[model samples]
Target chain A: MTVSIKLARTVKDLLQMAQTEYFDAGHRTCQGCESAMVLRWVAKAAGPNTIVIGATGCMYVANTTYYTTAWALPWIHTQLSGTGSAVVGTAAALKALMEKGKLPNEKINVIGICGDLGCADAGGLSEVSNALTHTKYNFLILMYDNESSANTDIQETTMTPYGALTTFSQVVSR
Target chain B: MEVVGTGTDAVAYALMLADIDVTSAYPIRPYGGVMQTVARLIADGYLKAEYIVAAHEHDQFEIVKHASAVGARTFVGSSGVGWLLAIEAIVAISTDRYPVVALIGNRALDDPPGAYGVEHNDALMVRDVGWLLVWVDTAQEALDTTLIAYRVAEDPRVMLPVGISMDGAFLTHSEHVFKIPPKSKVQKFLPPYDLGNRKLHPSNVISVAPQVNEDWVTEIRKQMDEAMKNARKVIEEAYRDFAKIFGRDYGNPFVEPYMVEDADVVMVGMGTVSKPIKEAVRRLRAKGERVGFLRIRWFRPFPTDDIIRYLSGVKVVAVVDRDYSFGSPFDGGAVFTEIRSALYEAEHRPLMMNFIGGLGGREITYNDAINMFNMALDAARKGRVEQRVIWYGVRE
Candidate 1:
């Protein structure tokens, strides 16, 4: 599941990437929020032949709601810690179907989007580790490490670094 | 082909006949045998699919859910805590409308002190959810019901997941001879699963199960409600085609009745407990007593129409529940509670009582069935039910 990290090897790739907006406009994110911007680019870079499984996080909440979505590509929601499990499932399904002649044998990008609380902390790592063991499956797990739990109104998560200010930690002593 | 196999083997054969494209599995007793058999089939060239050995149950269930979303026929199974461990994914699969077929080797939910025997509670946990639930009495029924399950679940009228519950030890471990219809017959009965515009594919470009606020939630749930309602008809249609294709039909798709036509008292239940009750029905008939058995196959649609038609005329309907729900209204089992609710719409309104037994997999014998019949018959003769529920075999 390695895509060229450098999308702009030439002026044509950059111009081509700029011309297509796979991640559409009209999201609910705060005007200054960088997480949504990252999501937009991720969805765009993954392109139209991709299925994006957005884990429950600030990015997922701010970018997409029922009937309205910033993603022009096919998207599904997964649980916060479910990004790993979902990516494997989606990738495995694509491979299985393509091999079985149920679906066209095309290289579809399978990307799972998650946040810090979903990926590094909680049981997300175990799920990711399990998913990573399936080396044959083609998928990418894109982890967005936001310092606090944005979905629950900025509650302090295990990913919260030392002396970080959050709704849960107004007076940070350590 | 005719062969003797356990309940798990029956489901494995169905998976092969269905030609499932993806299966994710984890090792949990009773239910584990099917996945093992599937792996062997994959190795021996009997079946070819992505056989993933998942890290745990959550991954196991989730993998199949996503696979089914992309229009791949899928299968998965677990028992006891293994099923519960994947509860989060279980709820999502039905709500997301993925027709992923699963098997539940009905085991007593954990802390059984190493007792991994049969109980209905494991599957009953999802009774209120949108999943279609069915209990099979034998390996033959297990094989047939599984194929029917796929047909019903994948039907455009009812695109919901189906859980085929087979009693642990009694069915999962024991072997029985059953017919395995050729792939051609199965193909005639079950069409290839298609999601059309609803599938999550690049060609079909649709977002599924997005985050929603209060506004759109109710309508989405109402859709599921209608789908569940549609399942009753779809299930009936599937069984009708099943009989036509295979030349074997269990008269009613909802409930299997044995000697209940002219019975005064009918003992009702599900799963392997029906075996003992059926034996008791024969013995009671020999003694000139009008006692019979009604084995409920489908538990989710609750079989209200069948309940009204069958038990409404009987003098007493004694429900032999192998699982219990403590602190419930009347302290009855899940089946007892549901049947009581269904009978409320009945015209005759037969007297009903619940017999809570076989909890934690204690065997309910033919003698126990006779004891239940005697008590129910007594209540019928007196035209009153003194106790709403009785713990039939408990020491206390």
Candidate 2:
């Protein structure tokens, strides 16, 4: 094979070897940013036994757009700020099942993600409070900073830079 | 394959490349793009991990922190007030010493005057919240910063969560040349996340953020403070490594200064606002104005020394903010009151002025920046603090 072709084949083989099951094709959305990249990498890096609790946002809309999804492993979509609570519930269930010897011997992993505006600006306080106050689950939180409400057009957010023009600032003049 | 895109996708791609294992999200203006991209990756068979649709921003953190404790790398985002909603969690994650990385889209806070676009107020409000905060001037930085955030947060010396801020649209929607680094390179930078068996196990149970005496609290706080101080070096080191492998470097990793030497006046701001202000400064310099600019790359931990050193020689300093302090004796001025306070004992403290502008997606023009410079010069000459804070570009 040509060098380029050989490289592509090697990548494919490595991907296959990793045996990541959470990421699959068909989920809609842009690929230029880190949101998709995180999901892609996470699904690949995570082991075979894993469960996902998806919260409301572009991830939910795109992945579950047609009900048919690319999530190879078990996944569920919960309330906007409830991903944490759901994961807790899932972890509790997993522990119960494991203790009952009903769960397989595979090592299981659980995870969560949210936008900065969602977790830092919206109902993030209570959810995070619960996480700190309780120690039922262990996971990583990834804050994707796109700096805009993409579902909406270009608008300023808490993370917006001072003196940078945006739609809301346009209305008021000095 | 080629496809339509946004900066959010770029950030998602960067995290995926970093090997994040868990994901959570919520919908809000300006940041919905991040979630959209995560959803797409799951469909493309590029990742294998759990994607959770959080009930709200709070739950998002809860899930991510839980997962992190159990040794899963997680991700999330939000915009404007949505970010404010998550502020409490932002502090909690840092205090818990969880290695969560949050990407914050800067926007205005709701109050007397309302807006929907870029502002530094929200991020500034939490400057002392014990998180390692990095603000990116471009989409590429957004991607690179996320990678660095993880490495920095995971450092045993700095196990505090990180906040990576990007301006709305300026970095999120703007296109830029980006190279998807090799997986092996990423592996070299970030090792497999080891949770140290902190999760719930029958043999051992430990409390996270358990109630403790003042001494314990003081010690924990001291450790966090030291970690932040140490992070300055860690950030510089990570950027050096990134430059070696990725061919990009953010100088100093704390602040970026432009043409400040021999400058009589210096303009200070962060994120995309700094870009235009820099251009405006060039214009003023052409007209014989000895003006300079400072872009704050790291907001949290405030980089007080850097600010003092850069402003020491300047005759006048102008601080432009998009968010207001509201009800402060400063008359609802920009959030730089703290910066002014830090300069109290400086030997050559220049005349300082604060201006609130470009809030709620409003545009801050080159002319507006020029006007701010003139105002600063006028204040410096008077040798008296004249209305320490001025609302630039405000309408009656």
Candidate 3:
């Protein structure tokens, strides 16, 4: 009897090994934030078969500047707080495409990334409620916890810690 | 990779390293930085997934959950009021059995006009929704937990969502030294998202939330309950595997005990508050006070056996909660409610008292935690039940 262990480099390695071309660049924000890195990596990892639903945030304004773009794969900039419905629409579209024998059998991964304030504070409940009710699509929800309204100079969110002062705290306290 | 960064960025990096396929974003206060960072990843070519900017948080969740149902690893986050607003989605994500990872910023609930800082109420309010909740005190923990969360949430036995809560300013904004593990190591730990072909085929249509009778509902709930019960072991296993690859270990899903082995009184807390409480406990121990600290690590599927075992010999227990459960006879302490229920006995129970502090982002300093412990000791000495709930660091 022969024992064999076949090891394909883990998903992480495959992602890193895959070469990424800058489809979106020259954005001014945190240089090494996870949101920026994860999107770039996923674009390459999921190959050209992926579709992105871009909501209103730093990602949309900063990365997708004018006609010059950051996404090499199919992408859409949906309304703020309505990416959930948009992604569902895209999933439905993809499923329809597959049914029409238009798309190949390669798996398509749909992803949703929102900030803490967006998901936990606003618009997250309804989107999540709808997703729960309908379960045909495949998606990923990546939440970022920066602990401030970074675009607006560190305003406090519901996630802020006690005693840590924020822009709103001073205003509300005063 | 070694510069000062927010936990939100670290979370994105972790997802990228874990090979997440889909991404979505909606911006709100305190948590907007995370989306900003993910946007940068798109620009820098570090992350290559679909980056969707939804109209709002609800849309972001729908995108992620729908993707997850078809076996895509998903991520999302919110803070304070954002979290409260996302509460409905939290329940939906869990009930649907999607492996979504949320990075929630802890903030106080509105009402009584609290500060814009960290509080546990945001996550506590949604604990009953069946998401696996863990609080990280630092950026590194935030990143590590995000990776571990996916592994735990995606396990067949625990196909549930996970919430990795962190303090807004403390861990989310603070910079720290962290190692970006080699891609090979990360890949070895997290496998690609693979839902069987049968479930995802176009012809094989199945309803996710079918209208069912009580028995079907009970069975679903039971499965969810069992999945949570099994998550403890899955979390532990994932931690062990992560440590082996990344050289960091997130302890078991039980309260972190500090000097409790030989102490007469113990103070318990969760999230960022635990960091200072640990230091305060050390100071008390150095000063010849037999005091200890128990940091609650896992919030949901409350560690009943571990809490009972750890506090069984202690003479007194002081449970500090950042959120209050209003209108309760116990004066609205959430941690107290859970701890008391776990320790409820017909004969003997530890003299458990509750202290609510750090509401609406108010700080719980070393002095505040120590004073709470002292008050608990005083109550223990008298052998009389003190007020069931006390507020710490509040002025009359």
Kindly give the stretch of ten consecutive residues in candidate 2 chain A with the minimal lDDT sum: A1-10
Write candidate 1's Cα lDDT for A7-46 as tens digits. 6779999998888887778578888677878777876677
Q: Residue by residue across B1-396, what tens digits does model 3's lDDT show? A: 564677777877787787666666776656667778877886897865556665555566666665565445667888777677656556767886777888887766566544567777788877876898887767777778888888888888888889888877776776777666767888888866554431333333322342345547787888899999998888778888988888776555456777888778888888778877888888888888888888887787688878887788677888888888888767758888888888874134788888888877777887887788778878878876568778876788
TM-score evaluated only on chain B, model 3: 0.93
Instruction: Give the runs in model 1 whose Cα sits over 4 Å from its true position.
Output: A4-10, A170-174
Order the candidates by TM-score, highest first. Answer: 1, 3, 2
Q: Taking the tens digit of each residue's C-alpha lDDT, what string does model 2 give over B248-313?
A: 767667788999999888888877888778888999899988889888888775777888888886
Per residue, candidate 1 scores C-alpha lDDT tens digits across B1-396 of: 899999899989999999999999899877888998899889999898888888889888888888888888999999988899999989999999899999999888878455688888888898877999999999999999999999999999899999999999999999999999999999999999998898998887777887887998799899999999999999999899999999998889999989998899999999999888999999989999999889999998779999888888799999988898888888898889989999999898999989998877789998999999999999989999999899987896
Instruction: Give the CAPRI class of candidate 1.
Output: medium
RMSD of 3: 16.9
Q: Please, what's the RMSD in Å of model 1? A: 1.7
Model 1 residue pairs with clashes: none
Runs off by more than 4 Å, candidate 2: A1-174, B1-5, B111-115, B197-205, B213-215, B332-335, B380-385
Q: DockQ of every model listed? A: 0.76, 0.05, 0.06
RMSD of each: 1.7, 17.3, 16.9
Which candidate achieves the best TM-score against the true structure?
A: 1
Model 2 CAPRI quality:
incorrect
